[model samples]
Target: MARFLGRRLLVAIPVLFGVVVLVFLILRLIPGDPAQIVLMGTNASPERVAQVRHQMGLDQSWFSQFVIYVGGLLRGDLGYSYISHGTVAAQIGSRLPSTIDLAAAALAVALIVGVPTGIIGGFWPGSIGDKLATGFSVLGLAVPYFWLAQLLILLFAVDLRWLPALGVGGPTALILPALSLGLGFAAIITRILRSALIDVYQQPYIIVARSKGLSNWHVLTRHALRNATSSVTTIIGLQIGNLLAGAVATEVIFGRPGIGNYLVSQIQLKDIPSIQGIVLFIALCYIVINILVDVSHGMLDPRVRKAWAS
Candidate 1:
């Protein structure tokens, strides 16, 4: 287990390094001058722009800047943002909790809604439950997030007056965003889990268990659920990566003050330091979630645990 974890960590190092380099270079390549943005007008004198560029280390060669950036990263210095006038670490810290909370709530809603629907759909294939599940899953996939968010607002917030339209602090603020994010994942989870459950229900062991006088529900819960969970766990793990990637769009539409909104602001302002920091932080989040999922799988399945032991 230790060796496997070590290997994952080792691989993550190069992966994160490459992400940093790529984002840094790409942001630099974008046709905009940070110094000029600071100058606030195109007619700013060249000498004044050069001084701002030098101060921000934009005057350095790409290689030199890259090396310095890497060194700063190794020392836990994520550099200052040219636009925000604040350290990247501070900026990320301020907004991290909102995004984390939003993602967690959304994922929770997905699992709560998806898991049972999938189990019922798989266990009772061709029945009314299966048809309903299929319909909901199809709608989930077909509906766009922004559209859903807007429709939810119009229905619940505007006409019905049950929830707030914008901003997030209370339960009302979270519901729309969470549902918007969860619906997509719920559809995906339902599909994967239904397939896994179907396969598990057909296994010889499940048939034997049923023949041995166990009720269908008992057999499904005790045997099929455990077997199906392994696949569900993998999907849930991958979904964490998706959340980090998709948070931006969801947050923007919802007007939630999260890392996604911060990222959007940074990108618009071309704040390279903040952009790089956020990207690196996101990569770390993905790696950590994947590792946790692997560890969880090891704990849940003895075969996996034994494989790690060997």
Candidate 2:
């Protein structure tokens, strides 16, 4: 277990480093000067722009800037956000909880809705229920989240007047955004889980369990679910990554407080430090989520744990 964790951590180092470099380089390509944005107006003369650039270390060559940024990262510094006039980490921390809460609620909804639908689809692959589920999952995947978010707002908040149109209203406010965000994730989960369960059902052990006179539900719950969930666990982590990636649009649409909303605001404001910081944080979130999924995989399957042990 220790060795497996160490290996995962070791692997994450390079992935994270690559992400930092990629985001650093990509953000610079966003058109317009970070220095100009920082200096605040087009009226600043070239000399003044140069002075501000020098002060912000934007005057350094791209490679030098990358090195400096990485050096700060190694020391646990995410740099300062000129927009917020504070440390980037601090800014993200203040809004992190809301984003996490939103993502968590969305994930729970996905699991609740997706898992059963998947099982039913796998249990009767050619039945009408399966066909309907298949169509629903496909539609879920096809629809854009921003558009769905609007539809949700229109239906629940505007027309029905059951939910708030914007801002956080405790759990009720959480519902629409979560539903919008999670429907797509649930669609994807249902398909993947259905596939996994179908494959599990065809395995030798499944036949053996039936031969032992186990009830179908007992076999599914005790035997199939545990085996199939290893794959489902991976999807859960990927869903989190997707959820956070989609968060900017969702938060903006709903007027919610989260890293996504903060990030979009900073980008439109052309706050380079904040952009880099937030992108890095999002990348780190992906890495952490995937690592946790891998750990869950081992827990779900003793073979995986043994493989790691050896």
Candidate 3:
């Protein structure tokens, strides 16, 4: 397990390096000068702009900038925001918790709702439960996050007055946003887990367990579900990215002060440093989450464990 983890970490290093390089180059390619934007647009005197650019190290060549950016990264610095004139790391740190809270809540909602619905559908593939689950999956996939968020706000916040429509505060504020962000992913989980479980139920081992006089419930709970979880785990892991993406729209719609909204605001201001930092942070999250998923996948399946060990 330790060796497997080390290998996964090693693989992530290059992936993260590529992300860093790509973000740096891509941000530089964006039109309009960050210095000009910082000086309140092109109205600023060229001398003033030059001074700002020099102060920002924008006067340096791209390769030099990249080297400096990377060196700062090595020291855990994300640079300063051109517009806000604050350290990018501090800004992200403040907003990241809210984003993480939203994402975690959404994931919880997804698992709580999706897993059981899938189990029910899988346990009786041809039954009404399966049909209902399928219908739900279709509806979930069909509904867009913005539309759902608005609908939820209208029903729960506007009409019923049971929840807050926008912004984060306590648990009540989280409910609508989490539901809007999570439900679609829940649909995905339901489909994947249902299909996996159905396949597992038809496997020879399942048949053998049943033939040994084991009850349906016993075979399902003790054997079939465990076997099916490997696939479900993979889907769940992959869905983390989707959940974060959804949070972007959801946070905007609901006025939640998460990194997603922060990114949007920075983009509008053409804050290149903040944008680069946020993008790198998000990419790092993806890499780290995937590593965790890979490790968990190995632990869940002996075949995978053996492969990794070898």
Using TM-score as the measure, the top candidate is 3
Give the clash count for model 2.
0
Model 3 vs. true fold: TM: 0.96
Candidate 2 achieves a global lDDT of 0.87
Please provide, for model 1 over 185-204, each residue's C-alpha lDDT reduced to its tens digit, 9 standing for 90 to 100.
Answer: 89888888888888988899
Q: Which tens-of-lDDT digit does each residue in 1-310 have in candidate 2?
A: 8899999999999999889888788656767887787657457889988986886678789888888888988887887875678999999999999999889988888888888888888888899878877887899899998999999999998999999979996899899999999888989889988889899999999999999999999999999988988999988887788899888899999999999999999878778888888889888888998999999999999899989978
In model 3, what lDDT does residue 210 have?
88
Candidate 1: misplaced stretches above 4 Å?
32-34, 37-48
State every prediction's TM-score relative to the real structure: 0.92, 0.92, 0.96
| Candidate order (TM-score) | 3, 2, 1
lDDT of 3 by residue, 137-202 (tens): 999999998899999999999899999998878999999999999998889889988999999988
Model 1 worst lDDT run, 10 consecutive residues: 34-43
> Candidate 3: minimum summed lDDT over ten consecutive residues — where?
33-42
Better of 1 and 3 by lDDT: 3
User: Cα deviation in Å at residue 131, candidate 2?
Assistant: 2.4
Could you tell me the TM-score of candidate 1? Answer: 0.92
